[model samples]
Target: MKLVTRAGWGAAPSRYDLAYIASTHGTKIHYEGAYVPKSLAAPGAHGSCAGHVRDIQASHLANRVENYSDIAYSAMVCPHGTVYEGRGLHRQTGANGDQLLNRAHYAVCAMLGNSGLVVPTDAMLDGLVDAIGWLRNGGGAGKEVLGHRDGYATACPGDPLYAWVQAGAKRPDGTAPQGGTSTPVPSSGGIARYQVVINGLSYGYGAQGPHVAEVGKALVKAGYGKHYQVGPDENWTDADTKNFSDFQRSLGFTGTAPHQDADGVPGPVSLQRLLGHLPGKTVKAYGMLPFPGRSAFVLGKSNPAVVTLDNGLIRKGYARHHAGAKYQPGSLFTTYTRDNVRDFQRATPALAGDADGYPGPLTWQLLLS
Candidate 1:
């Protein structure tokens, strides 16, 4: 039951906004409905699996929705027992034949089918079961795992796999492993707008609205902000300029002249640099520092880097001062965030030994996963 996260799969992002809200109705299974040689299904053959998804998305965007940002499946399982994240946790997928019906359930596609030549091995079946289990628990899915034929007028998920889906998509005992997220590295393409949203893609004096606030928040994250004693806000003042310029210069930028000193204006280059590593909980949100600075996240640190850790903690249901308390959005790190990071580190097998409440590179990777 090994799982490959979205980043691990090296997916090319969609050019469309993610607007679909997922349902808890259960999972619908499907297949590529075409032949893929067994060699593509070999163990660790992640390249083949990723390539297959990309090709399908190209077809889906061109023929299905004409501008669909991504592939139709919520996720896909390979014959090697690895699950590749597709549209991720939220966002409605374009799989269902009925556009309005796409909200009924999540989609899981096992990379097989069409020519009826590739058979699903025992490992592949177990992988599929594990994929369903992960989606059911992690992404708020229900228990009624069914094939595409169950809800749509299509002979999808294929016959043999369809029968397996009906048989509860159960795995043999102890066959599945927990999903994985590896250490962070550069993404394969341009940074996702969802990952970082700046107003008009830049910020300066007189900018107002959520985008201005986003810039202020980013400034706060970078250990800047001489004026945000109460927290960053939408109003752009001289303090914003000072802090932004300080942050810009900190990145090694030095503007000279009567109007020198980096100017505190967030052009595209500086703005992307300040986003750090914080990802929004939903689509189309303004972003933060692109690179959170070059330090390990720890307690007592009150910067944009803390926001990165806080976002991760919030996502896994471990954030908040106490039970039933909502996390203060873009707030400074508190005891609660630290404790949750420690708890998550302790819980993760790969990170159990390093559960010191200080989120390093590996911790961020796992949290993103």
Candidate 2:
């Protein structure tokens, strides 16, 4: 099972140190209890899971009523079987209603919510078992495993999860304790396969296509079509370029070298950020860069693909290891580059299992796309 440390996820520091508890009654299962985006469950979209946890922590901290010191849950489990440390071991959780209930058990939240991606995956079940076992063995927790609603008034951990709790939190292979009949785990199925790719050459003076119109429409929807005198159409114009440049600038692409460019030509990353959220379509740019084989990214090897990979990591906000003055990102595939790649792999669900600090084909495709 993959474990993502708080640092790996870019979590904010807690407002205060959490009070330590030697032991608890057991682990209490919790769910998001709201509408979760189906996009989050997509194959290559698991990198956003860390952002979700951070958002939860931000919300908890900003809640005037709860006054939570950090994220309410002790830890969070994603559908991809990755465990994220929240207010980790030995800390009192603020999720289970009041003080007494909080003290009684450590909290483990499934990324599932009431609406989208509600069904728990087999991997998710395994992750839950991992978290529960970790708490029991290392955190001094007892044998009891419970849903959030077991002692609280509100319905949490929802029906499916509550049912799982009642069945003694059995593992997917039925290895753990069991009680009532086991509930069949459902599939988390909202991945959009086809991605809209806007050709970079599709813009400028003579360029014209349905794709251009689509880009204009997306730009209008994203509030970046202010330069449009008449609105988006098939024919590409300077207005489209100006508006696209503005959109690119919004993504912090203000230069024109290596990978940083706000030249109004839609790059894969910027284009995806602009239109990836559209209901049923993922988005990318044309000229989809092919992955240079793994041999190109090794210690002491200097390749342009390394630059591309590093830039992708930088765009994904995973460049801290190499962003320092001592060793900046370049063509050389150094330890700094490898470490950053490892961090990216650890955060991305599809790549977490093979986070060996080396770029594989899947990792390359996902990072660039």
Candidate 3:
């Protein structure tokens, strides 16, 4: 089997080694035996890579931590065509049947397990061919690869895919290998927001009602509004209108008509600006910095030089911890006041002149960078 490191793949038992050789008597072919989306593969075929393999590994580890006994397989074949060594071929996994049949068996899991997502990817098939060839040839005592349900009661490895496994194929030199094509790096662009915690409270960016107080606070700090109030009920109020008005004004709307309840309530255009829809305005947020600390806001415009300087420092790991969606230091204008700014200016040589500490463009640049 082709074993290498990649995302979704880091666990234990790095690769097939002498430790594995001693314990494993033969090879057992089992499907992660789960289902996966077709998008997992390339456009034309089911070509997988180390990255895809790693995703499966990460999920498996997460699953094991949640409920299972241990990682379910000895090794797995990602759609990317990479084989990952599970608990090593030597260490026994609880994925197989009773002890007698489990020992001496090297299990290989096909990514996506057996959930019934789609036809197996060609790359996955190639991986299967390569893995079987390696197990049958390299292990000396050649053995047959079987589905999970073959010995157990469950319909593991699914029906359609498992049927194909029952019919074996031959190998030349007992190995299959091929080159790979390029694929784009995965991004979390459209992912759904999960409950993000802040100051011991649970909230989501898309949530509504009292939860919106946090969102409103984020908006105000981001420079979308000026008026913010803490109600007797501790809930956010329409003081958010100021932010909506500021955003609307930025869009070129003029006079009282712009602020009027023309559409009854705030429209999508208004919300869009709050969410950074409109262009040019700089929106400052608390960032992912940890609590009990202060977050800096870079105002005016987004200067590339400033941004680059800040990012460089962040990359070097000097900035405060990431707070996700929470704000800290309470009132930026008050808590930071003069003392905080003076302290910051004193500590950082980047700010030469006034120890006044009030962070203007240059001061903010120096402090953030």
Which one wins on lDDT? 2
Backbone clash pairs in model 2 (N, Cα, C under 3 Å; residues 3+ apart or in different chains), count: 0
TM-score of each candidate?
0.45, 0.51, 0.39
Query: In candidate 2, what are the lDDT values of residues 93-208, reduced to their tens digit?
Result: 99999999999999999987554345677788889989988888789988888899888986688767778788878877887744453486321121111111222233433457
Candidate 3: tens digits of C-alpha lDDT, residues 1-369: 466532345453333332334445455666543224223443433333444444444444445344333455666775656666555534555566766556657667775432212235556666767665555555442455666776777656654446556555322232322222212212133222222222223222233454356446556666765655452112333454445445544543223231122211233233333453311123233221111101122233221122223333444343443244522222123322344456656666756466664444445434444
Residue 363 lDDT in candidate 3: 52
lDDT of each: 0.59, 0.71, 0.43
Lowest lDDT sum, 10 consecutive residues, model 1, at 188-197
| The 10-residue segment with the lowest total lDDT in model 3 | 288-297
